[model samples]
Target: MRTPLAAVGLVALGVCLMANPLFLPVAVGEPDPAYTHTVQPVGADAVAGLDSPAAEARNGSDLDAVVAYDDLDPAARAAFDRARDAPEGGFGVEDPDERVDSLAYPTDPRLGDGLLIVERDGERYELWTRTVERESDVVLVQRVLVQPIAFLAGFLAVVAGAAVALRGRLGGE
Candidate 1:
């Protein structure tokens, strides 16, 4: 009976983990000084083509084939075109996410940059993006989520310790 209960609990725990959001690839790439755009569950049909290969690749190979940056709306297209020939922005001395920003670059001359990602959780997918536009004022999103696995593991440890103590005291051979 105890073995079956443990097995059922294990299966239940696995299911819970599978449903978690932290298990997904939720990356909080560096903020772009000139970029300020956020899209969740990105619509591939509209923005995919406008995205550069670098953006597509960062999101994953599947998006590399799917994003058609050419399919973007005219205004968005113009924004990209403007950035193509724009001057490159100054690099800050203490930027930690500069490497990630390098992977996502601007297509126009206006000196903006961006990144797109397809975060996967089980059979479901979430699209996330970061765009840097050169402007005086900018608002950044805190794109981080907590991991439930660690909390669950800690809870299980406490439960297991109690169970062992109970068995030793209550069940005598």
Candidate 2:
């Protein structure tokens, strides 16, 4: 009984080691600064995009994909175009680590990809949202949830294995 239990524990341990739950790749490739945008605080009541047509049109996009200019509503497209026309307005540096007056950079110059200037509660903000390569859903789940659970299970099995091997010496029937 103890031998079989020990074998099971060994197998579980091997599975855990092979899974490598510690280093899971969530986002792939080097993070580009072009996609890195400043989310500066415009005002306390800057909730313009919460229910606006522009926000509605931008729904259901893949995490890796940016909202295309054509996909936005007329109002959004106009704002986008206007923002693209003059890409000099700086994103205010609020943090000590942030550089002063960081300008917006487009991912694709021909596509007119760049920051979107928005005014809410009479305050302005420059938004050049992040776009990066991310791992698939299956791999994400395996790394985040499944692997950790398996590792824990393997650890528990090892403990059980030791207990089983020591049962006779520990005065258990």
Candidate 3:
């Protein structure tokens, strides 16, 4: 009976640990600047191509000329064309040695020259700036979750101690 009760306690503890959000790793990445813009050339071209009414008319379809850059509100569509056309690594430093070969975990954004940027959708998005500081509590929570077996062992020790104490009291009675 005591063995089954202890097993249940162990299982409950495992569930509790898994449910804790603090055990999860913080997703590290660059933070985007407020004025930054991401313009995917492929998507932009596709939108442009579709806006051509002549092409649609020639094809005998309900075609509309792709919206011109001028058509876009100046305030909403920031000047991203120049940034998009420029060569990669224009925003920040690139780590040539850092190869993204593994998919097991996400690569941490590299920091350089007070900025960290990641290229996505043919646009650079800032993930972080200046220094990347890790939260201390994140380290403590991860340390505990990393060694789940140790937690189980500690729990078993407590159960064993309790059983021994109970047995002693009963024997004395």
lDDT winner between 1 and 3, please give it.
Answer: 1
lDDT of 1 by residue, 1-173 (tens): 56446545655665555454554434445433433223333344434433456546666544443334455555443333333323531222124343233334443412123443323332111222234443222112212323455446646755664565466557631
Which window of ten consecutive residues has the lowest lDDT sum in model 2?
103-112
Clashes of 2: 0
lDDT of 2 by residue, 28-73 (tens): 4443332334343333343333334554575733122334445456
Alpha-carbon RMSD, candidate 3: 13.4
Task: Between candidates 1 and 3, name the one with more favorable TM-score.
Answer: 3
Model 1: number of clashes?
Answer: 25
| Candidate closer to the true structure by lDDT (higher is better), 1 or 2 | 2
Top of the candidates by lDDT:
2
Candidate 2 stretches with Cα past 4 Å from truth are: 1-19, 23-122, 171-173
Clash count of each predicted structure: 25, 0, 13
* Alpha-carbon deviation at 154 in model 3, angstroms: 12
